[model samples]
Target chain A: MFDEHENGYFTEETSAEVVAARNAKAEDERLRDCVNILVKHIHAAIKEMEPSQEEWFKTIMFLTETGHTCDDWRQEFILLSDIMGVSMLVDAINNRKPSGASESTVLGPFHVAEAPELPMGSNICLDGKGEPMLVRGRILDTDGTPVADAKIDVWQANDEGFYDVQQKGIQPDFNLRGVFRTGPDGTYSFRAVKPKFYPIPDDGPVGKLLRSLGRHPYRPAHFHYILEADGFESLTTHIFDPDDPYINSDAVFGVKESLMAKFDLIEDRAAQQEAGFDEAFYLVEHDFVLAKG
Target chain B: MFDEHENGYFTEETSAEVVAARNAKAEDERLRDCVNILVKHIHAAIKEMEPSQEEWFKTIMFLTETGHTCDDWRQEFILLSDIMGVSMLVDAINNRKPSGASESTVLGPFHVAEAPELPMGSNICLDGKGEPMLVRGRILDTDGTPVADAKIDVWQANDEGFYDVQQKGIQPDFNLRGVFRTGPDGTYSFRAVKPKFYPIPDDGPVGKLLRSLGRHPYRPAHFHYILEADGFESLTTHIFDPDDPYINSDAVFGVKESLMAKFDLIEDRAAQQEAGFDEAFYLVEHDFVLAKG
Candidate 1:
């Protein structure tokens, strides 16, 4: 039905329309809409950039290398999306919440299913490398009602800024990862080493792109959380350490003002002993609010 | 210095800006400009689409598959660009010539270097399975002056829609492919079977995408050419048959109205005998104009 062109040839002026018109017979409406939007935007971008043939080939090569860099463990395309701020943009678009509820961020490629469940006061730092810290938090609904029994799954990098999965044999299987259930008072406390700033896996094409753009690949120190409760929406987010150098310039743009938690150092050995620490440590307190599903 | 972001955090509203700001420190100005433009367009597309998290992941998966489908003999990403019309768009943007000059199109993935050189009036149809055709063309400058000794390289698929390179044993080496030079009058002629419409190498991700978009993988029957001379810009393009069903819907979007040539069936046995053909044949005549370098 798209026989508008008597000669049916391509011209620069109608390139996108010609391509989109070919989809008139597409059986899937979603596919048609998606393809149309994609073609339109791609054409717009090409017109804006006016890329030369060589530059176009360079893009193809970069995308090919990005695909080749992926394996069962690594996803360079995701890294590309993250560094481009696309992941966060998609997350933001998908998760528009009412005020007072915690905002969500990217569920980075590092999360694993079935993390070990632990008591509220359990320590997740099996490495014992960085300065000890205590994190205590409450789970509440948007209107201030307690969300007891909420499952809080957390994970983070160690002092060396390496995840347990990254240093498979060196770090314990579940190093710096745990799942805790909020108590009846909606309170949950965990002891662990302070999170440290870390560079993303930068040995791939995405890393090369970041470097070429004069951008760093370092993300601020942060703890990952996937909080879920019976009637509340599950939240995948990060809690950033306010003192980290990259706090303002996270490589993946995972930091938010509401997600930042202050880490206060405590010099009192007595207080540390009372909290079951053998030496002085730091304290971080922040509450999380979830919206109804 | 991209330290304009006192907070250096990515917000949905400032996502593209934050990414573009990083390029302020790029050493290569061209790279900086290209990257800035790319980031702006990509962010604009994302905001316009507002793709869901699942849809975002689907895109990543598609790109990864497109990359993985490429190897030494094939480039699926290029095919993606070709079918999407991006390759032709780039070519048009880069090769804008004056109104009477020959327009360029995509140099498809099938061209090979070092085709056998032949004198004018040579027959390139080694296998000879289809109706024989004579192609006589003159090479001229945009001013209509002769451009003698211009090298004309041409190749096309056989009657079964397969290139010699694609079917090494079935067809003779370099069948339907040759290079010729214009004589003092800037006239060259060669004999070859009429080219048939051919499907692109569509057993990969690109093919799957085309199927999903309700687009066929068949390009119009056409002859590929790359003409060059000492002081003129080389032209890479195609001469498509006007009667081909896919002429208006070339899978690669490579067809241009000015490039379409009519193939006239000639029933004159006398002319066929004079041209050394043993049966009824076809004739195609066209002229090519090149711009001065």
Candidate 2:
């Protein structure tokens, strides 16, 4: 009688073995194979940790609450994966670039599908709220040759330290956001106010989660970029300001030594006039190398 | 500047890998090592599933709710773990008996630390609310020699399907729960009411968990037993009635082919008179085998 529906009960139909095979057999053989392997190892781990009846019940409740706490805006499972470092592991395994090539960090929660296209040197910071800054960078290939026509998608926080998404009504529609195409010489220049440090959303379940785990919600000031072009690998990198207090202790473990660049404070009037800024200016320059696909 | 310590930030003082390499560690480093390995693997598993931000936050919330759902009568985490099959996994790993020995199973949530002691052949049915039953069994070594003076902790639900724990106010203390000692020949006999099927508690977080996962909460009718002796391995086993409706689908995945037993109904008037019972009776005989230490 037990063998009749073993497909739904155990991985195998036969009870020849004293122990039950711990997973259900899926109709698709490949999915079944994956699930079987996962279930077997999971059961083996559980067997090793002989928790009492009360302990078992508590685990069930935890998983249930994980589902209930989910919504369109908040993803507790993703946060659970991130803090537990699962997301990084999977990302690392999938994106194994050779040494000297830039490493990929988390895409983060603020990325939108589209951004407004702007001129090569137009001010992306429409809010006009921070010390004027000029960012200049060259997109290069593995051999250090310039990659013309590279697309640089960039976004950062405003002077008050909030993304447009977080302060929808308070901030302008595209505050401190733009997509710029590199000039014929592989040079891309942009104007924006200095980015400021901000906290990840904290009023929802993630906030309660951070509080319970005794972790803070702050992220250091950094510029987000996704540079893509033909024949070169797309590079997703962040430029962390050396002065940001949370640079070494980014909550998402995103900061890298190669990603840090100093924003040199320019006091010379000649340099300021050339850059078209009257006040003291901060200048940042870094070249991004794309790995060959 | 990023490396300097801040007032509110915290950091790990010592790394376990370094401590494990030193000779000054505690004598019970094995347990510590085991726990470290477990935590590493568990965390690794979580990282692999890069859940979204909302999902991550929900997981923490779920864990908090699991703790809040616990009370003196119900432990949702334990029930959760049980359904996840972790409890049985722990039991299997801890109890590695040779063939022919009584196999161990989950100790269900209904077990109390203490039960009333009863003499040989005494009836455990204080409420007299179940079908008349006589239970007799022999405790044996793996090679078939009887084990003398073994203590058997036994309990079962009443015919209407309620445990003493479920009805603390109405049912007498330790009703249908007894601690019986084997006679000189490793023989034990007791009269009791037949056990009945019952639902696990559904009002707590575990219930909410089951509802979310689309799982039913039920267990088959059965007798619970824990047999212990001086020089032999302890045995925790259940004698599940094959006729119960839930026999095929015990919620904890606890039913084994060898653990099922038959209960025969007897209408013999002479035997009923000798036992001082009504005209109808039920007889059940079971044998338990303990593994050699």
lDDT of 2: 0.69
CA lDDT, every prediction? 0.87, 0.69
TM-score of 1: 0.97
Kindly list the per-residue Cα lDDT of model 1 for residues B99-127, writing each as its tens digit: 78999988887788989999889999999
What lDDT score is found at residue B112 in candidate 2? 74
Give a tens-digit lDDT track for model 2, residues A191-215. Answer: 8988777776666555554544445
* Per-residue lDDT over A188-208 for candidate 1, one digit per residue giving the tens place of the 0 to 100 score: 899999888888899998888
DockQ of each: 0.61, 0.12
lDDT of model number 1: 0.87
| TM-score of each model, paired residue for residue | 0.97, 0.64
